[model samples]
Target chain A: MNQADSSTIVVKRTIAATVDELFDAWLDPDSLAQWMHPGTTALSTASVDARVGGAFEVLMHYPDKPLRHHGVYRQIERNRKLSFTWISDATQHSETLVTVEFNVASAGTEIVLTHERLPGQVACAEHTQGWTLAFELLADLAAKPLVLVTFDWVPEMPRGFVRDIRVRWALEEAGLPYRVQSVPFSDRNADHFSHQPFGQVPWLTDGDLSIFETGAILLHLGERSEALLPAGPRGRAETLEWLFAALNSVEMASLPWSLLQFSGNNDGTPGWNMMDSFLKKSRLAHLEPLLAKREWLAGPFSIADIVMADVLRLVDRFDGLADYPACRAYVARATARPAFLKAHADQMAHFAAAD
Target chain B: MNQADSSTIVVKRTIAATVDELFDAWLDPDSLAQWMHPGTTALSTASVDARVGGAFEVLMHYPDKPLRHHGVYRQIERNRKLSFTWISDATQHSETLVTVEFNVASAGTEIVLTHERLPGQVACAEHTQGWTLAFELLADLAAKPLVLVTFDWVPEMPRGFVRDIRVRWALEEAGLPYRVQSVPFSDRNADHFSHQPFGQVPWLTDGDLSIFETGAILLHLGERSEALLPAGPRGRAETLEWLFAALNSVEMASLPWSLLQFSGNNDGTPGWNMMDSFLKKSRLAHLEPLLAKREWLAGPFSIADIVMADVLRLVDRFDGLADYPACRAYVARATARPAFLKAHADQMAHFAAAD
Candidate 1:
């Protein structure tokens, strides 16, 4: 939320990093440079002394002009609060006070930013927008070192469809930077459970928060950018409902059926018959009409689409979606996105590299 | 986030209702009475006139003090913003300015409340806490009319373990108010798919957000209180990671195996053997040590416990936990909670009512 007046601006954001991690991101020159710019690829240059009276400077490489912002540390209460005197071209080259409070909250830090002694209403408004974009950049930058916990390699059978691909698709779509860390499929360790309880792969670690469950990972990543989840209400609601619909509603049944397909036995047995009917009637039949009506699950492509299309791709792989044209089309539409293609290729290469 | 100084108080919360719905919640006296009180069960009295220059009164019945808050609306922009002059005991009976801006966010409204012209620092601080508490109460009350979509009835085989029970357990634990809406199991309709794409019961409809996937619903309810998800970083992270573990990691394997058991066939087939081995080696074996070490999945019993215990209960029913005492004990510990017992009894009665 951003609230501005004639002389001050306040902004707050809930982030998935610890107070210590967040506090350091500000004072550490290298870290400060990563996300201090407007675009994900745009990196700033920063120098920090990081003491009570230390000096710090960040020069943002804007396309129009290189904007310079410099400040001196006014207060530092490690992991709790930080205050500095800020000066920038946008601030009329006059010093303004910026205080950041890092409140310990579930999953990360609740960062409250107060920029006081603004020149006037215009500066207040501009600074409000400036900090908002900076935080967005900061979030995108945080994704750079994100550790995506996944199986190093599996047999060719599940190569492209492994759950980690869902997280990959979202990250690629958002254009967030990340590197993959893998655990061999046949080897799971005690340390793995620390990241993922049931010992499955595709848990995401960002700063202090380690999130598992492919669905949960997708949901977590969805919060990072509007590309994964639209910031608008209607689209967001549709994306969420459909995201769950993908997991519980569609994949919930499709997954079991796909597993049976993989085993390639008991084709006409009682259990097979029941599961087959459930997937066709309870899952696919109900989903076909809805898919035929919408371009994506939501208005634009979203994290829900990534999850659902991924879920549907499995069914298509096993020929389970032979009868649903709309479902197949929806999958095609989603996978055609450059993000999905890149994610898929990277997953294949990751397994290949392990080999 | 709540930030206050001598002259102002600012509080913002991302809530799960439409801007229109949220805007009306402030001006509709009847709606205001439902959630304007501190406690979920405690109802306040409210009277409002929906226009600029109109007055509104809300008398909250506290344990000892019947605090009265009255305000005259200065500006009213439907579904956008509302500005008023507020007078209350907490503000030292001062006629302060309160402006509420409703921004359309993904799932609902991002409500920004700015209370300015406070009497002094004490008044500002007190009002900040007061507004935070009031917003918390509003969120709890919004859960009042939540409709839990579930099956009317199913056969005895899946009766005690319908997925809806997971949602019910969280609701009971959080002490949130809700009612069940039954969709007949055999009669799957388009209406059902609208709420649940897979036509599986247990999607939740909370105002504009109809979240499906038992996992997603639990996460949504988790946002309402600390009982479901603690507000601390570690507990919250554990709950999230484990909640997904139960769904994608544990249940992902258990459900298929359970379905085979339900059919009472393919006991020793290759597919059954593979599934059995997977359930034991990949899931339970890895889970036992972690479960044996901790009484609850998180620091305190959390929504993750609700999901994991329910998942384990099903596997236990099939005699799957025979060799895993730790998993068995963990399930028992979770089920032994009063909230779990109430949720179980109510689920049983709900099915029996259909009969």
Candidate 2:
């Protein structure tokens, strides 16, 4: 069975988590069961013997049948690498070699998976396809604990106004389950600043990756599902483009204007109001034409639409979107989604519970 | 020769350009010469007979050897699709069918290329590798004419303060050649408003894609080269995070404060100056510890560094970064790159020539 020209497939992915978390997940029965199976395949069982020379087994319950996969651990380098010999029902004696290496990347861990020594052409091709799907699931599982941080309570004026709602809306749209953690509104301590540099609420943590910006957190979630982002490159690029546009261009103008109104400074300064009005109006005017033709910002209701809608909703709240009918409708359409309704309801309930 | 199970390799990329422009580039000899070959492989000659049933030839001059690729046009549908039969020295008699289809993507055109009918396994493997490289090149060529738009002149106070410098610096860092187009500073014409709704300088156009916002433009350039943005996913994600951090988080705070200083409104308002100072100082203080440990924002000299450095440089100019020594040093290190020096010099020259 020594096919000298046997093919080897290598797949690499960078997950926004530490090496320890990712490496441990490979050996943890629960984590392995969650991600080892391909799309829509249920894991019947995952038995892990994590040490060298130990055995492990996983059973995938497909719609038609169940497939048993067994392996013997050959090497285990904690937080660094692992290698094993794979044995399956179809290729019980062939014994494929699979090696996974974890390298510390800039912000996370890069996992390099090499599957070697498949018996024949068809098996090689099928294994390659399986690994691709499995790796994507692994990437999703490795970046875990998508936590949304907010305040325990806020005044009625700023109740729904907290930034965590944007994140909740995104998670609901993507159908990803998450937990909400709260800090006391009265005291902003060192722990708050450690997670969020600005000591602001709505910072997110997926595994070890803690990001402060709501825009960044939305993008991190967008990577997992096409419901929040499109699968194609064109849609993904445009989504990122408009995502930045909402944050930097639209929100940058709307935020200060909204702040001035809240602080009762809209009519206080000599030229601040005029500058604020001109800036907001000019940005809205630029957006009118695009919204007139397209239903969503990046065609198929992507995170771009989510972000742009969220930014404009604030404007809509302040009655600032009256001049732009298309943008107003866009926001209306986005908010009318069932996911948005649930997210808004959940957010309201969470804050109301505190009261 | 009729290998029924012959392999077909398909590659698709969405270029941020119109279909008409991308189609013309495929036929234009000059454009074909620029992107027909893979990286560092020079195009020796490109002779075109673009009409259907006509033949065309291209010579690729690699350092060690020369290769000639000949093809005959089978069908052409101006901006939608094209098909040809490819004949090379290796497969002169066993010609391959190559089809390219263009579809309107969300923000641009998506090109799908299929290379079909390889005679053998080795040929199939070789062709797949070739097509992948060629497709990457085609994507770069398809998105052409990266233009940076700025004002013809600005007052001495905002001379170097122009936002276009950020785009220019990014382009230089990516080693991308770009053209600068200027609008009249005195009149902010309708054309200016159309391109930049805020009548701001420093929007960019790549082929048919015209995008405003310096942050957006830098990201567009970052897509072209890993020199500006890391090719790895982790670094890229972190780069985007920090890029937004510079814009939505840091610049959002700094720009208004700097503008107030430029307009000599620093001492005018009793509470405005206090709010401005508190906002700027708070943001800066948050940034200090991060800069202290890392040489670059995201652990590499990426577009994130370029952005954070540029934003902090402005703060330093206004004497606002006095408390943040690490940020100051980081900016100095980034500006010290030859690419930054060239971009700064070119931007100054472009404006000075207008004067």
Q: Which candidate is the best by TM-score?
A: 1
Cα lDDT tens digits, model 2, A271-335, are 36544654456688878887888898777887777778888888787788888999899999989
Over B207-284, each residue of candidate 1 has an lDDT whose tens digit, in order, gives: 677777777788778888898998876677667767767776677788878887877864687667777877889899
Q: List DockQ for all candidates.
A: 0.27, 0.21
Best lDDT among the predictions, by candidate number:
1
Q: Report the number of the highest-DockQ candidate.
A: 1
Give a tens-digit lDDT track for model 2, residues B214-256. Answer: 7767777887898888877677777877887888888777776
Candidate 2 — which residues are off by over 4 angstroms? A1-145, A289-293, A322-326, B1-145, B182-199, B207-209, B268-271
Ten contiguous residues with the weakest lDDT in model 1 chain A = A34-43
Clashing pairs in 1: A152-A183
True contacts kept of 2: 0.33
Q: How do all models score by TM-score?
A: 0.60, 0.58
